[model samples]
Target: MDVPFGKPPVERADAARNREALLCTARAMIAELGTEKVTMDGLAERAGLGKGTVFRRFGTRAGIFRALLDAEEQRFQAAVLSGAPPLGPGADPVDRLIAYGRERTHFLLARQDIARAAVERKGPVPAGGPVFTQPHIGMLLKQARLGLPDPETLAFQLTSALEGPPLVFLSMDRSTAEQRAERCQGDLGALLADSWQTLIERLAGR
Candidate 1:
């Protein structure tokens, strides 16, 4: 008899508590001092955890931001899974796709800092954007019945299109960071949302 061999071991309760405390402390430090000022030593000191614990939990500084981004992604995914109509459920597949694209565009743009910071300088670049992107898009495409030959491939391409540009943009922080952030929330968001709506509508044969 063969047993399953790939399950991740559960975190011990004390370990989970330490992780929670560290993440909470990191967030406050980031808010007060910005992402650039956060360091492993700083985080460990603030959380009252040892440096070894921090190093063990997150092997590199990028891991800290990655962990934070992972938590935020979970919350965002939860909203997509069970929050409300259009983005959540009870809407046409085409509508949901459009809404998801719009929301995802803003989500990536707004969190560009954390997303960028999550990248390890020496590690291979991540592809297809964040978790759930391809699968979610594929499900919506299939439900929409677009008559496309390769929805799976299209999903992968679309995920890169939606997430790659913003995170990789050099212009993202060229000018005033505050101004850039404001525009992202306002005009830039509107433009991206409208563009996504147009793309989805055309694909749906609207």
Candidate 2:
């Protein structure tokens, strides 16, 4: 089968060996140090590979971070999409969305460094289209019976509010990170709910 990135396909044997070595070395380094300390040069030395080879495999520090974040995001998505109530399939939409935001806030707080790096160094290509949060926010608004004049615009606004404050606060002392995240999540959830209610009332009056 053809690869998506225009690279020639690797033979199965070579690919397996390379994958195993890379995973083993990366895990050992991460265990000894931490994700932030796993530099390209350090990883290269540990894996017995050239610096260029390490870069070729992962692109950049952010790329490696994203690879790790991708795993976490997948787990989060699965829980929100399928696992349980409030966060998954068995709750009302508002509850599900609130749960989603709360979980996201907790995750981002825990992985602040990785989250910041991912946001700063976005993927080489945009994932879908001009608006990133439209689908998610639109679904929530629809379920809440919120008739937003422009779902796309409202979605972007809500997403920004949800992600911005905690990131700013988290850059400070580590002692207050959890407290700040909890407060931010509560405030954000309230703002979103109130905003939707006001929009609905205004539309109803018109």
TM-scores, in order shown? 0.81, 0.60
The per-model lDDT (C-alpha) reads 0.81, 0.61
Q: For residue 116, what is the lDDT in candidate 2?
A: 46
Checking candidate 1 for backbone clashes, the offending pairs are none
For model 2, which pairs clash?
A: none
Q: How many residue pairs clash (N, CA or C atoms closer than 3 angstroms) in each of the candidate models, in the order given?
A: 0, 0
Best by TM-score: 1
lDDT of 1 by residue, 1-206 (tens): 65455333344667788888888999999889988899999998888888999999999999999898888888889999898988998899999999999998888777767766777875655443556988999999999899999999999888877776665552345355557657677667677778889988998899
Off by over 4 Å in 2: 1-28, 45-52, 116-134, 146-151, 169-206
lDDT of 2 by residue, 85-178 (tens): 8877778766655666666656655666555444434334212211323466567757766555776677677666555555565455444665
User: Which number leads on lDDT?
Assistant: 1
